[model samples]
Target: MNPGDRASWNQTANADFVLVGLFGETKPATFLYMVTFIFFLLALAGNTLLIVLIRVQPRLRTPMDFFISQLSLMYLMYISMTVPKMLVGQVTGDRAISASCCGVQMFFSLNLNGEKCFLLAAMASNPYTAICRHLHYTLLMSQRVCECLLSGCWLLGMSDGFLLTPIIMSVPFSQSRKIPSFFCETPALLKLSCADISLYRTFMYVCCVLMLLIPIVVILSSYASILRLIHRMNSAEGQRKAFATCSFQLILGLFFFGAAVYTYMLPTSYHTAEKDIMIPAFYTIITPVLNPLIYNFRNKDFTGALRSTMQLGLSPRKAGNGRA
Candidate 1:
């Protein structure tokens, strides 16, 4: 082959994959991008505040709050994985992502997604122990137990990344290096492979089912038991408070797991380009923004903690001003 032809071949072999961003360069797309950027900011700030509040406030340092802080950390990491790159691509018009970098992104995204699922399931134990095993809540969910559960979730999540990333990245791509979605998601990357992936697709479907199904079972069973206990209680206010505490967790689980089931558990034949893009967007972009607001903003404890933190922050300033 000639020098130019060889160079062309090398380019084809090593070229970075280009991302088709979430929006186009039209007016509405611009508005949507702006809105998304704002959501990113809100998610970042909200999760950060929750983590800080839980750490600094003694009253908020229960098993449930410990799980909430971990969830906040997961959301913080999750949004950081995809949104910033997408926003930069929107602003700079440079959408090329190196294959190795794409693999790294996919690994972290998958790991965090798995961690959130397991963490949510683990969180269900808190409410169950709190209400049903009220006397033993502390003994059941001790600091040691909580730390072990957290460690288990992290290990399971990392195992998911380690298992899936290499398998997906091992496949050779066709000449076209464009990924249809905004990030290096599993489905989008698989669609670009030149090889037959029917077997791998089936394998992935099974993996997704096990990954999603196990936690879902745990969550449902835990909640069902809690519901039975709540129903047996005579005090109306007690029932209401118990229900309220569980509801936020149920809502968060529904949002995250429902979107995940739609994205990963369903048959690929049922997936359309538009549906694929939009559903993942709900979890990846919108859910992070909703988590902190739904989980904490409505909670009296969180708001009280926020008020106390604000007072503490302002007290020193007030004292300084009085002296001046």
Candidate 2:
């Protein structure tokens, strides 16, 4: 039962974990490889550019973009938690991962997911201050306050992972080590355990609801207030601008949270592993890529900066001047 003994460890399912990635059909592994490679490239490219633009382009140095920069950073970490290992799987055709490594992957993925949720809520507050309290927006979202928000997000997210990781890790996965899902999610990993995890399921569902629902509720309420403020505005240009800024973020929050809630909040009796593998990939891969795409495509400030950066072929000094 000692974890370090590889020979004896190989005799038990608990010592090693196998990941059943997205492609479970007759299609070549290259098909999934190509598809994942494209998305990985897109996610990397999109988020990296957004972060650089926000950092280098003075035009993007605003209250919203500050939080967006953090979000982009989280997206990068979020994708990193899963994608590289997946690419390795594609190349080696070896889905085997050490149990300890599986634990590490699960912990970070959950941690980043929690961080992302908090970032979305913090972002919602940005727009609420913008449209609802235009005069006070700058004063309210000061450097100190932004730092505080960012710090709190990291702390809250780390606490969620810290609390959940140990509890889930303590479960005995003696029955199986093969996880049907692409990544090491709480639900999927729980399914591998031999003991009765009904209580654990209930515990996780509660955690999921509290962490996911509260942030989403705050986001929704903020948007509703934003909409009301925008509606009362007499300037059509300002109204359109306000709506444009928050719309993509709102869409992103809803889709990621909705899918996450459906996947994690439901009781185990309701769904099977066969149905679970398909769900996380969409949120994990597709949503991250969409964040930058939505911003670059729709937000004029972002697109303008992007265009200018392209025009200058990414001259850092000129772009940072806010007029490339």
Candidate 3:
């Protein structure tokens, strides 16, 4: 195809390309690909194990587990959005992603963001129930209630993904379509649009500020109060245990919030492909792996439950009572 013909074709179809630029040149393509592929595999395995553990262990059937499951599922989608494109781009240096691919990436990315917000909010509420209203915990956070909350989070996230992605992608742009990021991140996509992005930018900022900012504020405020309440406890063990609970959630929240703010708030005009990819990697990939390890595995209760479940699975003599 001649240059003019190819240009015409490019306008109609999405071009696929790799977005990671490790050095000034592309000499490290193989190394970058291998590193990314390894992380992708780790993330997939870790999140998968978390989901399976949550499902099989009846002791894990709590509100916290419900949110943890959602978070894992979102991370699975998070890795789904970026890893395949990077793999293809890495193998062949033709790292160009077409418009349709961009749309898909954008949708999943937004959905995951929304889901993260909802899950965090739900998590915050779970602690409040246990700490503030211990007597009514079971009644207030019944199975049906927890299911409704989880379903609402998913539905809200899907709605946000569908509504906002199309609005951004519909911008008329005949020139300047090189996305610097590994995937179609919101800010990067906006920067590529030919249309005036002022309003859309404002909208995204408001949505993010409301969704992210408010929840973070609420989380921090709740923890602050919880800390004071814990300090007032006369028993040394009570204080230690309460501090431990607060610390776990606080650390996880900080990681999630810090990575998110960095990714979303950076001026798209100033964003580098490397930074964009790295920030999301922290939140979506690393955080998911850490969530179960840090929160669930470290808990003595969960460990005991896991051991019991394993023992139950290994009880072969009990199985002899059943018909072959």
Q: Identify the leading candidate in terms of lDDT.
A: 1
Tens digit of per-residue lDDT, candidate 1, span 107-172 = 998899999889999999999988989999879999999999999999987887888889988766
Residue 278, candidate 2: C-alpha displacement in angstroms: 1.3
Better of 2 and 3 by TM-score: 2
Better of 1 and 2 by lDDT: 1
Sort order, lDDT high to low: 1, 2, 3
Runs in model 2 with CA error above 4 Å?
1-14, 310-324
lDDT (Cα atoms) of all candidates against the true structure = 0.89, 0.82, 0.74
lDDT of 2 at 246: 84
What would the TM-score be for candidate 1 when compared with the true structure? 0.94
Candidate with the larger TM-score of 1 and 3:
1
Looking at model 3, how many pairs of residues clash?
11
The best-first sequence of candidates by TM-score reads: 1, 2, 3
RMSD of each: 2.8, 4.6, 4.3
The best candidate by TM-score is: 1
Q: Which prediction has more favorable lDDT, 1 or 3?
A: 1
